[model samples]
Target: MKFSLYVVAVPLALLGTVVPASASFAAGPAGADGGAGGTAPPVLRLTDGPADKAAVAVTRPSPDGSVATVPVGDARLTARGPSGGLVLAPARSPAGNGPGDLAQVHAGDVVAGPTTQDTPHGVLVKVAAVHANGDGSIAVDTVPATLADALGDAEVDATVPLTPGDLKAKPLTSGGKVTAGAGPQGRGVRLNVDVPVPDGVEPTEGHASALSASLDLSPEFLFSYERAHWYGVQPSRARIGMAADYQYGVKVHAKSSASYATGHKPLRIPAAEVNVDKTVWLGPVPIVLSLKVDYFYDVSADGTIAVDAEEHTDGRLEIGARYDAGEGWSALSGPEPVSTATPALITGSATAKGGVGSHAQVGLYGSVGVAADAEPYLKATATAQNTPQGASASWGLYAGLKVNGSFFARLDIFGTRVLDKDWELPPLRYEHKLAGSDV
Candidate 1:
């Protein structure tokens, strides 16, 4: 399939204007001026009250296509309307007021939600709906507003299709018979092959058979997200996270059959193989990453008979990022193992009882600040006397991450393996086998 990867980075400085650390709610528009033809809006005054053990408010959409405010505890006031359509201003406590003063919400004001400290002495106001009077007075509406109301919602999903321009394929052997065709369902490219075999093929020592194909893929972009947050006195933190997943390698699909005359020698055939090398950019970032993929499939048979073997294998790499505020940069996460390789299947029957076997393997290697390696492999064998005998195979996929330079946070998911003086994660493995079968 065709797809593009996009990397996004957001800085905290552009989030929004900072407010007073002491005041949870920021100041609203100035009060209106009282003039000849101007009327003043109703005033909603709030006063500090005795601390209540339970005080909470929730803002949600109402069935009537309006927003609704629900409050619980000491004072319960419900308002309905669109959220954040109102405004709120800080309340001033009267002279000689103490910490235990009783909290009061006037007719024009409503408690949007509970405060972080859960104290009425310094009530936090989340204005839902309030009108601005010409005289600068804050007027209350039927709807309440809170921080949740002001933010709305944030969520997304995206996808990109694959095309032929994204893939390049070639034959491995000179003069090897190879043809490119449509992939399954017309989504990807499929390579077909038919190589020439030499006459008077010797026994197990030698026979003539050569056919293989390889492919290189354009860089693929995946997904990304950026966010900036400003905490009162704390340093503003700019966070950006992104991920990419792509596949490359040889022998993605191999199916073969061969026949030989009577002989005691067995023949081994390198059915298919490929190698790839490419450099890629980490979307929108200046960092450079390189990757390599290699694949090989082989089949062998001893005796005068016919043999059939087939193998389907693929490889994928997943890349992720983490921001290092201390270093003012982002580091990549270690690669993880994925189960996408199919088991190798080999079936054969010989006139003279002999043995047949096959092996397939794919290795994925990558380099960023550090080096990483992962391999998925399979093997199978079977024997036939005078009757027909078939054999199925099983395989395993594993990865190893080695640090060559500076140290970064370790991704615990990948097991650990120590090589030289560097620490590496043990490769992940996926296995599947047919019953009563040996590799």
Candidate 2:
């Protein structure tokens, strides 16, 4: 079944309140007017502590008449902008995550704090601040939740604000919910599991199924004729192969397409590898378990780690499982020391990548391996006109990018690398061939 694997972005609004200066303090009756039997008013006194801060200008007089005049002091204060006259106040100091570091905490709409609040849907995270001590140690503190929810989950994780090398954090929650169990080493289960389904189908309590299939064709036309030696040695040969495979399964299946080269020229044809898996439900509702297994030709020690996105009929997204084994690493190509006892390397990926509205696909299937200390070869002759008789073994990876239905192209870069010994092959030992279009 297809599923969404990308992060969803949403819009946010700003909300805040400010108090006006006139409402800050109210002065008592200027005359202290006691209605009946008025006594003498208490003498008013003024005290000046320091200069008024340079930035703080008294825009309006205090109603309580208790304003103390002070010279400009350096104390910071919040002020509203001139246009709208919005009031600003001193914001509370943010708490620290650990020693000398700031902590991230929030104080609103919390779902999984003091109570196991069941939220409609949201992301949750664990946070801590760690300070690295000089003695190769660290100090950690839990992140405060005072920060806005949006900032907390996305930016900061469950990490402490300790020294750079002093802190470690474990994932605590995601999707607006606290993760089950404890730290990273703790064993816990996902709150929900994904089940595969076909396009345009919504998942229900019962079992869901999905299927995918593709057709491929490759043709190699070659013409060759050899000279007849008068010494009674006439060499002529030709060969061609084309095969196709098909499969259907719950999660994945296996299928392939292959073609051989005509004559002695090596046939660089395509191959097939398919897989499907599904989740089986006991009753009509809620899936209990899921099983997924794929088929692909592994030609190298490092498996395929390639990823590409595709949209399924059911409005879900799928990604191709391809691998990039760093430099000097090739997928669908086995290791250099190819031998019977040596390990077998395999690489392949499956996904209808790129393009839109289906019909377009980018799949992977091929073999890449190594034979140590051995020059593996098969000999043959060429017949007819223009055919060449030569033995060739290609070792490299192929990447295909297709668009629409009929417009497709792929580039295969093949070369041999000796893994067992570097200087084994002489400079002239290597061979190069460009077989496809524009080559």
Maximum-TM-score candidate: 1
- lDDT by residue (1-439, candidate 1, tens digit) is 1111111211112122332212222222235332333222112122222233122232332222122332222332222225423223222332221221112323333343322222221122343344554533344444422222211111111112233443334434543321222443233333233222334332221223322223222222222222111111111122212222322222212222344422312122222222222211111011111222222222233433332222233333322322223443333343332323344333443221111111111111122222322222222334443435554333222211111122122311111112234333333344454222433
Instruction: Compose the digit string of candidate 2's lDDT tens values, residues 200-300.
Output: 32222232311121111110111111111111111111111111111111111111122121121211111111111111110000001111111111111
Candidate 2 positional error at 234, Å: 85
Q: Model 1: which ten-residue window has the lowest total lDDT?
A: 279-288
lDDT of each: 0.26, 0.17
TM-score of model number 1: 0.28
Model 1 / residue 65 / CA error / Å: 39
Superposed model 1: Cα runs more than 4 Å off: 1-163, 166-219, 223-308, 313-376, 381-425, 435-439
